[model samples]
Target: MDAASRQDADTATPEFTLRSVLVGLAIGCLLCFTNLYFGLQTGWISMMSLQSALIGYLIGKTFTHPSFTPQENVVIQTTAVATGTLPLAAGFVGIIPALSLLSQETDGVDALKLSWLQGVEWSLAVAFFGVFLAVPLRKQVIIKEKLAFPSGTATAQLISVLHQTPLPQPDGLTRRRGYEALQSDDVAHEETRVVVEEDVPQDVEGEVVKKEGWADLLYSFGASAALTVAAYFFPVLFAIPLFGTHLAREWLWSFSPSLSYVGQGVIMGFPIALSMNVGMLVGWGILSPLAKLSGWSPGPVGDMATGARGWILWVALAVMVSDSLVSLVPVAWELVRDYTGHGKREGHEDDEEEPPERLVPLKWVAWGIGASILLGTLLVWVVFGSDGIKSWATVIGFVLGCLLSVLGVRALGETDLNPVSGLGKVSQLLFAVIQPRNVVANIVAGGVAEAGAMQAGDLMQDLKTGHLLRASPRAQFYGQLVGSAVSIVVTTVAYSLYTRVYEIPGKEFPAPTSFVWLNLARLLRDGSLPPHTGQFMLAFGLVAATLAGAKAHARATGASWARWIPSGVAFAIGFLNTPSFSISRLIGGVVELLYRRHLAKTHTPPGREIRLIIIASGFVLGEGVASIVGLVFRTCGVGAASCWGCGTGICAGCG
Candidate 1:
């Protein structure tokens, strides 16, 4: 390519046309809705983005020639993948409003359900605001500082591998003659240079020629389906058994003496699920048991359970708040130091580091934010404001919602922290502070605030990804708007239909919304507390264990003590994961070690070896898919029947 052509290619904004945006939105929405459907059916959060990224990579490689540079290919693949997966994120955002509608319908009271149009409006607004907020922050986090977003790094690495492989040259007499001549030469040398280079390896050339074909596609799809099935039906089988047993024991003991063992056994089967289960066990099981033992039982444990739940809710909220505050302090301090003369010498010329080209200008961000806010406000006014009391209260609620969102962003640096629980607590407290009638308003406001926070976080991630890919800021902002709109509409419709068709008569689907209620109940009963106590305790324990392990290793092995400590911890943690997952990881690690050992015997290209690792990642993805599918079937009451004699329930046939 000419220099001008190269310049244009380098500088030109990849066109994110409306059509492209819609295509991306559609794909994302489809994947998201599918995942959501399965999630609701099985209670597993499938990683949709991984699927999208994989598919994007395949498509990019298929369409683009091997001659394309790694960077260029990455740009194409990432954009495709990100766009394809946008709907899932958008759908999640829409779920809040949909749930709100369901609440209102069931309760015959005012709830915070935004109409389809309103949801879209709010999504657009959030997208716009997020773009602007993220752009300023990007310089600090990504470019200048280079905080590692591991996912992005992995994506970049994959692209590099795809680009580095050389396609086979067509065979001809000239090529044969040249090769023969070069091979025949006693000392092959480049003109004017006597520099010696290592011979190119065959394995390196093989990777370029080994294009992903039908087998890969079929394997990915089958693996995904199988993994999802396994995950859904046999979560316990995949879980760390010992932890599950402990949780079961602790929780069951609170309910009934007879069930304690069973509960313990359950805990023994699933470890990672321990944190939440143990929290519940302590709060409900142990506390209730203690309360009963003390003759202080005021009501049924379930009824009185609100107090413990509330306590935990407050602690969780506080932890999130405090963690955000602590993290931000250093970041903010650095920002100030950078801007002021404290860090760099005063009046020193600003280094000529290349100014990052603007992706989305400030003006477009303002427009998006304004539009989102206006639409969100309008939605609250209509759906929530049908009653005069509700309408007035909702107006105030909307303001509070916006305020809380801003605070959440500032406090958390991202809106992923669910504000609903905190909001619920606040509402419950308000019920005590204000009249009971106003409780509805508080709940509405809290839900909206939570939704806003979540959407904001999503927007930030999307913007960050876009910035990295060098996508036009305007296109990203607009794409988000379109993506969110599609997601809200599709998700709402899907949720409504699913709820109607698959509504379990008495059993409520454990939506994230329930956590809001749990939090609110907790707040009303007790109050807030520290959230990070458990994490802190865990950290302390880890440190102590590390030191102890090091000391023991030094005494026993006479080897470097510190080296053993990390490995010891890793081994223990690996054992803590579900046996299936842990085993798979262990096997992969073993294979990698073996490969490296063999490579040492015969000098092979490092790049070729790395490709094997990438391919192995597909196994992890397969496991995840299996888990999801298993959960879906189990939730739908299909159990092992859906897996065609793959045993019953979660662990019917498991050893």
Candidate 2:
């Protein structure tokens, strides 16, 4: 290729097209609606990146004149996934359960529903912090430090293969060979240097390779639909749950295996599943019984009985927040001193070190951050009764949330884990102490921190994908901005409709995440902090604080001890919720590990690996689709209310 051709090939691909935006929005809206619906039902969030990529690739084939580029397809997938995982939907998913539980005066259905105006305003107030907060860290974390964003790497590789984009050859190497050189011994020599024949990427006789995109997608979709039907119908039809088990058999002690849990294992891997189980065991086996023996009554905290779970949550939050803040201790001085630019290091010159180009300009991002914070400030003040104490506390929470957002992004960029609830609890704990009497005020403040951290972490993932794909960062920023805006409106209407249609926080939806925040806020706000064990919490907090320090120390020194120690937040969350979730996740991880072992031994056919992933993703998507369909039926009053869940009743928990 000529220099100009190579330069053009290396430039950002065709992007910001109207058709691309429309397709993305269409795909994103479906995913946004379904993800919220599914999350409310299953407590899992499925990202649509890979799914969107495959669909976009197939759909792009129809626009033959321009021909769809891999880069453009990325825009479609990015926008869809970004929209699907918006902060407000997540916030509502978690918080609404607690809100529902809070308003249960006499087990009345739909007794208290937060207005669409209230829900949207609360989510809008601070959700924007995530998008802008992530922009600044790309240069420092993704490029300069080169954090391992595994998901981004996978997406980039997938795009490269799908597009057949040329992999660059080292300069001056070529497939050119003369017959004369091949016939002579002197052919190996180029003046004093021996010439080595370079391996070329392609050959003139190469056969045309075709992909079975349509066949594979159709087959996968069919299988997914079939599975969804079986999963949905078998339980209600036979009075047996196929997805998972909560029933106790006379001979069995542990709970049932969950397919969704196993699917999560496939996505999240073994370590996380194992760690989560550790927390469950500690909570259910060790702590719950112990707390019960200590004269504590079983009270409701979300879906789980309030036992040692409450204490575990408080201590875990304390540990995790400390660990999150302390992890940045080394960079703290540099950030405060010369954050305008990275400080000096050996062989690093300020003049030579070029920062990665940004999609959205730093100034615009900064302005957006300030504006978001300001918007959140006004919303919090107004929502919390226009009180001076609450408004000012909100401002302080938002500023702290912004600082924590950096940490949250860093945490996710490094660990593929964001301590979102932990950050919120930090705000909750702080605000709870400061304004002990004001539970609602405390929750609003914590919600800002949680929303900021969660969204920032999510956006960081998109930024990582854009970086790897050589995409326009600016385009991605706009896509996400647009997507989030659309998600807000769509999620608002969908969630509002759901409340009217279903009795939430009932047997159908546990809303585990919201349970923690809502219960904690209510407990603190109502002066009903349970178990009557302040001294134990104090001692546990001290120990947890020590562990948090140890984690920081281990990271600094590259100690092996770090791996042995549990994730404070995960374990704490596990302890606070039911053992079922943690145990099921562990089982899922084990299943995944076994499946991987089989794959390693079998050497599956080309694209089978990708197909297998699609199957897993499709399982998630299938269930989500089923849930949405069932929800629509329930809304239309065609759903069954039978004891055995017959007729139009798709899921047993449906209202």
Query: Candidate 2's residue-wise lDDT over 1-655, tens digit each?
Result: 8755644564545576777777778777777766776566545565556567666766676554575666676678777876777623347666656655554332222223568887777667765777787777766666565565444444554554456654232211232211000000000000000111123222210111125555555565556556544544344532233333332111011332444444544555455567667766766666555655675635432224553445455544444455444444543554554455555333222221222452567789889988998897886665445542367777787787878777666665554446565567677878878766555566667777777767776666666666666666777777777777777777777788777876665445555556666666766666544565555556656666676567666755868666455555555555544555566657656766676566557854333444444444554555555666666766777644443533333334432
Point to the candidate with the largest lDDT: 2
Show model 1 residue runs off by greater than 4 Å.
Answer: 1-6, 12-14, 17-23, 34-51, 63-154, 164-220, 227-325, 332-359, 386-471, 502-509, 516-655
* Clashing residue pairs for model 2: 262-588, 359-473, 359-474
lDDT per residue for candidate 1 within 316-429, as digits (tens), equals 333323323332343345456766857543332432122335355557556655565566556556544555124444444445545444443333232112222233334345
Worst 10 residues of 2 by lDDT: 181-190
For model 1, the local distance difference test gives 0.37
For residue 290, model 1's alpha carbon misses the true position, in angstroms, by: 7.1
lDDT, residue 522, candidate 1: 32
RMSD of each: 13.3, 10.3
lDDT of each: 0.37, 0.56
Per-candidate TM-score against the hidden true structure: 0.56, 0.77
